[model samples]
Target: MAQPIIEFKNFGFQYDAQAEPTLYNIDLAIQPGERVLIAGPSGSGKSTIASCINGLIPFSYPGRCTGSLTVDGVDAPNASIFELSKHVGTVLQDPDGQFIGLTVGEDIAFALENQCVAQPEMKQTVERVARLVDVENLLEQEPHALSGGQKQRVSLAGVMVDDVKVLLFDEPLANLDPAAGKQTIELIDQVQQKTGATVIIIEHRLEDVLWRSVDRIVLMGEGRILADTTPEALLAGNQLAENGIREPLYITALKYAGVSLEAEKKPAHVDTLRLTEQDKAAVRTWYQQTVARPQAPAAAPLLEVKDLCFGYSEGVTNLRDVSFTLNEGDMVSIVGRNGAGKSTLAKLICGFETPRSGSVWLNGRNLEGDTIKERAAHIGYVMQNPNQMISQSLIFDEVALGLRTAKLPEDEVERRVNEALTICGLYPFRKWPVSALSFGQKKRVTIASVLVMQPKVLILDEPTAGQDFRHYTEIMEFLRSLNQKGYTVIMVTHDMHLMLEYTSRALVFNQSRMIGDLTPAELLCDSTLVEQAALKETSLFTLAQKCGIQPPEAFVQHFIDYDREVRDKWQTV
Candidate 1:
């Protein structure tokens, strides 16, 4: 092993306002130019670990620390955040806070300017990093308008402009669509290969980020570093489920086929499937006999859309004769390519956007002319970006806003707010300033605020966009509870995994038309429909094709069973 650029020696920390330490007896080391991913379920302190590297934990966070954490050969116990900033460039999960410049170029040069770099040289350096991140054309655009993926890259460019030795990313894939998430991971790989900067990524989307480029995976659980192993070894291990995180879809599929790691005789994914036609036939036979397909739910329609032709501006059709029904107690997800009317339908249902020549019915009542306030009684809508919905500074106050509007008693407001905070895993920071919380935490707060309202129908627009695995599961489990209790839950998302697990129905949108309202299995099986809707098949679904078998219904059923089990386990006691 080479000399470690970073080291943690018996490190332990507790936020000044926290009752218990977030990280306990942490001991780790990172060699120079090594790319490491620190991952775990929600509340495992992955983001806190990033703070220690960037000198935010012991200083900005006002926390108590024992022992030492050193980065770039300097002990964190004594170094100031400004000092740490020179060596460790950080791109926070939320790009909104990270962007200081009114323009893309100016935002990238903010840190450089503070360092007293010459103006002429700053221009050259900013342009270089922006182009490297493929945001050159967006240099003059406002950061607010860029999509999730572009904003994340801009944040990375801003960090790289200072030429730091180590780069830290906290949940870089949280908000991006799957395609964008994959691209960001690829970009990180290309950048590391080119610069060899010691990169440490803290994220929950391990299935996408666990590429061959990363050297090791650091798994955190219950305030402890449980396992620091190669991604392959960790996936093959038994502890992933105990930590409340979803295993990769490929591993889960193999397990469903009654194949165990021990029986595979140390085989990698490539070696498991022989290319011989006979061997492929045997695998297909096993799946066909073993897997059972789950039947789609049997129920009456809960919400129906009829001839929903809608558009905001002239000549641009957002929704054209869109018609679909959401069954009672159903968890249906809408998946399509960008600008594919997924959000437009959600807005129409929530009464934010009215249809030009159609009607939206909720439980047999037409939504037309119903004030957003009237619709609010049944549907709780959370937008794509949490920033747009967030208005309060304190966490509890934000969660209680709707309850207060109803003129609930003070004690009743506290009760609902506290319950919501706990369900969303934000109770510990209930009184903290929303600005002080990290982006992932803020996303959780937004959900908690809505759940507190207890609406009969909850429509979440890209709720898991910038979430880590823990946060992702927390939300899915929460929604499952709502669905089980007979709330018709609908999510507008580009995440296929969310649909596969929680959704009872799948809606495909493309070219401003409601293409097909089908099951996840059906949607994946019809590759043409998926392509038309600008969606991709699950890796497992695609792998099944290579194995010479159609996707088995049993695999999809098993996924729902597993999701239900997780939901049952995580509910508030």
Candidate 2:
């Protein structure tokens, strides 16, 4: 049994500032050389548990503890953070926050230097780990200048050089593109196998995490362990749906077709799932019987970008000859790999950045003369992080901040704020403190603040980056409702599922060029374009092929239509 490298016996913790304990009676154990995944919705105490294991609760957070906890044979409550650092290494969600050294090689060697290892020995170890994580070529590059995926690899190498017994990864895929995310999972698997270290991953993207095989899954919600079991057993039950976690896409498709799932069949991984003739027949029949709804007619062009080209520096172009027309009442997704000019396009449209050789037109009016504030009336851009957008402490004040700045009458400000709050489903909490809301709720508050500006177009950057399936659905559906209300919606995102399910159109970018502008199904069906844009094909496409469904794109479109219909009915109920 390897003495269970990490154990929590009815352990609980509450920060001094918090009245109630974040974790409640958490009983968990992780054996040596094991790969375990911990997943839950927002406020589920998964982060609190990770803090306890990493020696941040008592040492850094100043919290009261109950019961007992141990990590790598050390009493976590009694051990100093410096002591625990020897046995457990943590990779944070944002890799940028953890980099201390300027260069990649320097960052990886920082830990060894602190221990005062011989220069020759430290160099050998750093090079070995850099090669192990495939960051050897990036040794001389600046850490912050690297891409999201590269930064993650450097963070991993920085920790691995310590020779720690356990590795803790907190939301490692939160900011990566699709291809980068897959590579990250593969890299993590390689590191675990080569090092024989105990691995614990805390992430909300269960489906993506299942890209690699895991020994067990720990599901948590409301400060308690809801289920601690193998991936197959957990997927075979209703716990994931009950706790707001998303299962693998193929499993959900099989369930939609009324195919029964059994743990023995290994429904966790798509490649190894044992499907029978009955299952194939069920999926084929369901696909054949389902008919896709007709797409709506395209509306008039509301915003137009004419041959836009912009560069921050002399020779480094951010956007090159980018042109697109956003029609009224349209919901479009702008997607690509990291640093693919998606955010830059939004900035140009919002007048934050001037295009070197282009023009922007809104309803046949040139916006070149408009200032950043003047453009706000026609276009609203909501940043990815709600904290960056929110300024006021109360919900009402936050939503009304923009309207009040314009010196609107008191009655008009109240009416506009109330209207926006109601649309965002936050009217009931209008007077509540902003800090009291959940992450998703705060995101909605940010959107409400934008909606009050009465903009014709709403641009959101990664609207559901860190959200679970339940919150993702809520936020996307709310945006869909707004799109239905004749507001043009543009989303700059990396979520392929959101693009395929919630959006009708997709604008694909590659190397700072608009490579493909097509339907989401069309884009996913073209493997060459998907690869070029650094996007992964949906599992539904593979499932369609396995079931002998003709023209996999049609099957995907049918699934999208059927899923939306089901959600629409559920919402009505």
Candidate 3:
């Protein structure tokens, strides 16, 4: 039998500044050439474990490490990062952060250059790895100028150029669109197979990572490994939700309808999860019992755009003659591929960028000359990166900064800030330092800051990107409540679930053009539109097809409506 490539025995890790250990008593082993997924909610120590494997802990993070961790027969804690790099290669969440070279080819050849490989050999190796990762055409391009997916491919090439024995991916799919994310997972699978490397992926999107089969899934929570098992067994029960991890939505739907996976034949993959005739009957019955609440008729338009055209330069157009109308109380999602101009549209609307041609009108007034600050009164734009929006050191101070800036009375500021914090589920952590909060929590703080202002239009870009199921639901539910209370919400997101479960309408963009403005159901059901927009068919839709349901579109719609109804009732309770 082959020796394990990675092993951990009673591992515990604590930062120098932290009073309590972040990871507690983790015991795990990965055999050679095995692919493993480590998944949990934000702040659950998934990344810490990855850091340990890549020799980032104790060495780079100033953390206290205990117990034993070995990577390819080397003690990880005592080994230098350089020593570990020869055996284990790490791909970070942000592709841009990993790039140290000016161009893709240079980046791929970096490790070889450090190893003092012959010039000819280094060039050959860079070309070979670039071709393997399908980034050969991007070799001459600036690493930072490529799309998110392309940058990821470049990062993969750079790491794999070394032919390391173990490859680690940290939140690989976090910043990608649905199609790109799926492709990235496929690429990872290909690399693992080709190199016969032990692969470990730390991600929050388990279902997405499950696009390709993995050897095992290690679910973590509150700094401990709760379950390490086959994907079939791990998802067969409520273990995921119990540990604050999100199981696939289709599984959640089946569970809600009282279908039992225990009695059914266990399928290896979620896509292959088959429902019995009786189980189908139960789901149909649940659908019949649930009633979807009708949305209120939209009021007069609050925001209108006409012939909007903008670009960073004359030849490059981000938005081309885009026109859309957002009515009062509308909850709309702007979705498409990575470079589909979703954020560009948001910036144009929020007055961060002036349109080269055409006009934007708010409440019948032209916003062409409005400054970003002037527009902030009516439109609140929360960037995808919370770091850009966060400025205050304390959570309470951050949320209340907007109110205080307006010179609101002390009592008014206190009441509104606390109210926003409570809505965002951050009141409990209101006193905590902003620096100590996780990425998801900081996202909530930024949202709370915006919520206190009570802007007529709230535009959030990828609001739940790095968040867990619990926080994602909380933030979406809060946004839904605000929409009901007459705030127009526009979300720029790649999460198909978010669009289907919450938004009433979707504005689909492709190649800087708004191709379709339709209901989520309409957009998802049309395969042509989904393909053109670089969106994936929802797993619910795929499930219906796999189950041999006739009129699969109708089944998808029914499931979506049923889910919305259940969510509404649950929120109320």
Structural similarity to truth (TM-score) of each candidate: 0.81, 0.97, 0.93
Candidate 3: how large is its RMSD? 2.4
Per-prediction backbone clash count: 6, 0, 0
- The positional error of residue 484 in candidate 1, measured at the CA in angstroms, is 3.8
lDDT of 1 by residue, 263-348 (tens): 13332243343344554554465555533335556878778889999888999898899887777788888888667788888888
Give lDDT per model, in order.
Answer: 0.78, 0.91, 0.87
lDDT of 1: 0.78
Q: Write the number of the candidate with greater TM-score, choosing between 2 and 3.
A: 2
* Residue 17 Cα positional deviation in candidate 3, in Å, after optimal superposition: 1.7
Kindly provide the TM-score of model 1 when superposed on the true structure, using C-alpha atoms.
0.81
> Which stretches of model 1 miss by more than 4 angstroms?
262-286, 289-298, 309-321, 337-339, 363-365, 382-456, 463-478, 510-516, 525-536, 551-573
Q: Decide which is better by lDDT, 1 or 2.
A: 2
Give the Cα-based TM-score of candidate 3 against the true structure: 0.93
Flag clash pairs in model 3.
Answer: none
